[model samples]
Target: MKPLSSTLAPGNGGAAGQTGLETNNAGRDMKIIATGLLVLMAIVYFTSKSYEEVHPALGFVRAFAEAAMVGGLADWFAVTALFRHPMGIPIPHTAIIPRNKDRIGNTLANFLKSNFLITRIVAQRMHGVDLAGGVGRFLKSPSGGEGRLKMGASRLIGDIIASLDQDRLGSMFKGAVKSQARDLDLATPLGQILEVVMKENRHGPLIDSTIKWAYRTLDANEYVIRAIVFDRANTVMRWTGLDDRLANEVVDGLYKLLADMASDPEHPVRTKSEEALAQLAVELKTDPALRERIEQWKLEMIENPAIADWIDGIWENGRNALLKASRDPDAAMAGHFGDALMQLGSSLQKDPILNRQLNRFARRAVAGVVASYGDNIVKLVSETIHGWDAQTITDRVENAVGRDLQYIRVNGTLVGGLVGVSLHTLGYWI
Candidate 1:
């Protein structure tokens, strides 16, 4: 914002033009009337002096006119001296405003600093204001403030996205993701998750699913299993004992064994499998060698060219989608932002603790700003005043108060004349 002094400067054009014109006209009219009165007095003084001996009343009139002229001229000189030298001649104590511009500026600045910029005054005013509450109420108003906020947000986001360098953003996104992945160790966290799953008995579903999958595989590949068993029997004993019936019986026994394992949770095979899985979970958590191997595998996956390309693709695709959404008016990205802001405002209003904290934060921020920069405002006022042209300052000030000053000239003439008449009457009586 421009300084207050700048706003009052002469060249800063504004609505003051018509008002200034009226003041100027009034000052000019007053000056003319005062000058006319002095001219009338001068005429009476000269005419009455010639007839004073012939008319006693004319002698008193002459005295009044002389005093009136003197008073009017003196007042005119005094008023003119404030803005400029009387009759354009150099005179001491004249052109007061122009000559003392710097001092006047300093005085004005000091006045403002002492009266308006006091920290206690500012803090007291701030304390009386509920800035956070006011904002919350405005957001929650039914006067379409929320709709305007949404539209404003949409335009702001659109402008920002339009100005962005998409390629640069994508590159930065990929680099950050890769850097974070490289610095992270996944094995220990994964092992801890597995430990939690086993401890919580969440692994039962997984074991049951595994058994069902194995049974389906065995049923589907029965012919292959039987063929393999028959081939094994031939290789071991070709001439004497093994035959088709025995192979069939062996395949039937294998199927029955899998059925038993799937149906009975207490079977030896099931018990052994659970024990082995439990041990593996324990080893993953406590064994350093196992962890090291897992870490090596993780590193290989992260560093692989295919994985890097996939990560880059994810960034590029996401960026493109966001950019497209930002440009589309119907995308609702800005609407979502507005809704989130409204929700936040509602929360702040409903939550007393949050509202209090927000107000406190605002107070501290305002106090910090005032404490740090309040002096600058005073300096700015002084500088702006100093920068104004002397004549411009005179014209503006005279225009503002010149009408009132002219009345002083009028009163001086009338009072001086009245005193002269009273003195003449007293002298005659004596």
Candidate 2:
């Protein structure tokens, strides 16, 4: 992962480019100064040599200028040879950086891998870093203006979702659901749920609902019941209206039974229903045959086209809803997501244990990445450098340290001039 600073700032690359440009300009200016000093020394040397016969002091001046010129030229040659051949001459051991660019790249890569990319070294360096706290602070109150972080994060999420293949995503989601369902032990969970219901007497409401439904059905179909009674009745009984009287009695009796079941919680029918449910729950859990049947049913359901279609529909609806929510600026989901992030950040900040765990996890994750991909990273660096042209490598190296090297030329010229004057004095004294 890129550093947070680089990730957050889009202009970092431009800034780095500008910095390199500035460094190159400084190096170029220093090179001109160093070369101009050598030219000045040469002019002085010739002028002082002509006046040496007129004044004895001119000999010392001539010696200083000549020595300064030689020292400056030597230093310039050394500096020039590093990046390219001196005066474009193909001198041995010249153009050192360009000729050995590949070796330098490999050496640099190895140095980085050995010193920085090792898991142990990385872990040690990251030991004091409060990654979790830093993240928490960033999320809670970002560096940029208010709501900028949240908005950017939301936009990123929206883009990612928009770019995905919805059909493929839906298919993958459906497949995952099917796989989970296929592996799930439906019988055991069902039994556990049923047991909880029974323990809490939650099945009472179900019984009451059943009774009410039965009562409504019987009331609405009274005529149907009466007609059935008439079809079974004798012709004499129907003609005398006795069958109608009997149907009314039967309907009234059924209504009274249902009423009793509804009014009485401990009614025999209710008790019997509860007992049956409890027994089924136990059979679901403990009975091997029943469990096997449930497993087979679960497999069938997983294989059913209707179930697959239902899963696909679920994925489609969910994906569309998420997409719409992500796109909408004033969406409740977006607000909720932001709020959740803030809450998590607050929790991480206040909760030491959670913060520590998160930090440990982050460290381990980073260390694992370094251990796994360190070699690949080194190889990439080496290959990238090796692939660059010789001139490109030379310019980069020169820009980085060329100004300092120019200073070396200036120092050598001054130092050599002082030494020459000292030597002339010593020889005259002898």
Candidate 3:
């Protein structure tokens, strides 16, 4: 930004033209007016000859009028000199504002610092503003609120997600879980976050939804299920070559048993299976050898084809969600995320203690950023100044505000004449 002084500079070509025109007009007008005034004063002095010869009052009037003429002439000359040579005489200290335009700019800068740059005044003006409240108010609006949330969250999440190294993540997880034997003791911080998910019942839905979906879509394909039934029944049929009725009876019994197992969770057979699993879970938790076996089983299970297929499905679901989220802003699932962010912002704003903490963090962050970038600001100034030619600076200023300055010359001439008349009158009065 250009300084105020630079902004007030005279205009170029057109401004120069206008200035020239005004200077000429003022000069012509001043000369005509001064000469006319001089003639009038002379007439006054000569016409009162009787008073001048005998009367002190007439003499005094004559002196006064003569002095007034001299004052007016001197003032007119002085004022005219500001724009051009007075009486066509080239003298120093004339037309100062024009001849010393660059100097005037430098002095104007000094004047600004001396007159306006006081820290107390600046601080007072700034303190009068409730900047924090205004910012809060702005961020409270729906659109504005969303915009602010997106800006910060997107910056953070983008950086994090983009820089994610799966290997590093896996290693970090492994390292984190490495201290425990078989099972890790959950940290309080982790537990607290987990508690919220539990309290909110968010985790229940995920497990319930998955199980429900799997059950609802159970593969009841006749060939696949019947194949298992017939394959087992065939062993008996092949061994005995049983009658058709016996074969049919055996297959029916086999299906009934499978159905019974599937339907009855608390059946004796199911109880035994459940107990064995529970016992294993306990053994894995308490026994080192059992824990290693369990870990091996877990790793093997993860490497299974079915697990890969499940994982592939999960990856597809996640990718699809992200794709839809990024493309379709109106997608409820994605929009909910934006809404959640807005809610977070609102919560932060309402929570005074949290707000103060955030503000402190923000201030420190801002101060660090400012400190780091402080040189850039100075560098920018230095580079800008270095890049700019002096003539360009002068021209830019002149273009912006040069025309109005010609009025100064006009004011000078008129004001000078008034001062001259006053001084001349005072001279006579004495």
- Give the candidate number with the greatest TM-score: 2
Candidate 1 lDDT tens digits, 1-430: 3444544445444445556777789999988888888899999999998899899789789989888888888888999899999989999999999999888899999998888777777777788778878777755552454655655455556556556677797778878987888778676677777778878878777778888887788789878876776677764454665656677687788778778887887889878877777787787777889888987887788889999899888987776666565445344334766577677778778988888888888877787777888899899989978998899789878888888888998888888888887888888899
Q: Rank by TM-score, descending?
A: 2, 1, 3
> What does candidate 3's lDDT look like per residue over 10-62, in tens digits?
43233455775675565556556556766676687677555666775565556
Ranking 1 against 3 by TM-score, winner? 1
The models' CA-based lDDT, in order, is 0.78, 0.85, 0.52
| Clash count in backbone of candidate 2 | 0
Q: What's the TM-score of every candidate structure?
A: 0.47, 0.66, 0.34
What global local distance difference test value does model 1 have? Answer: 0.78
lDDT of 2 at 18: 70
- State the local distance difference test value for candidate 3: 0.52
Candidate with better lDDT, 2 vs 3: 2
Which candidate has the top score in lDDT? Answer: 2
Model 1 clash pairs are: none
| Local error of candidate 2 at residue 115 (angstroms) | 1.4
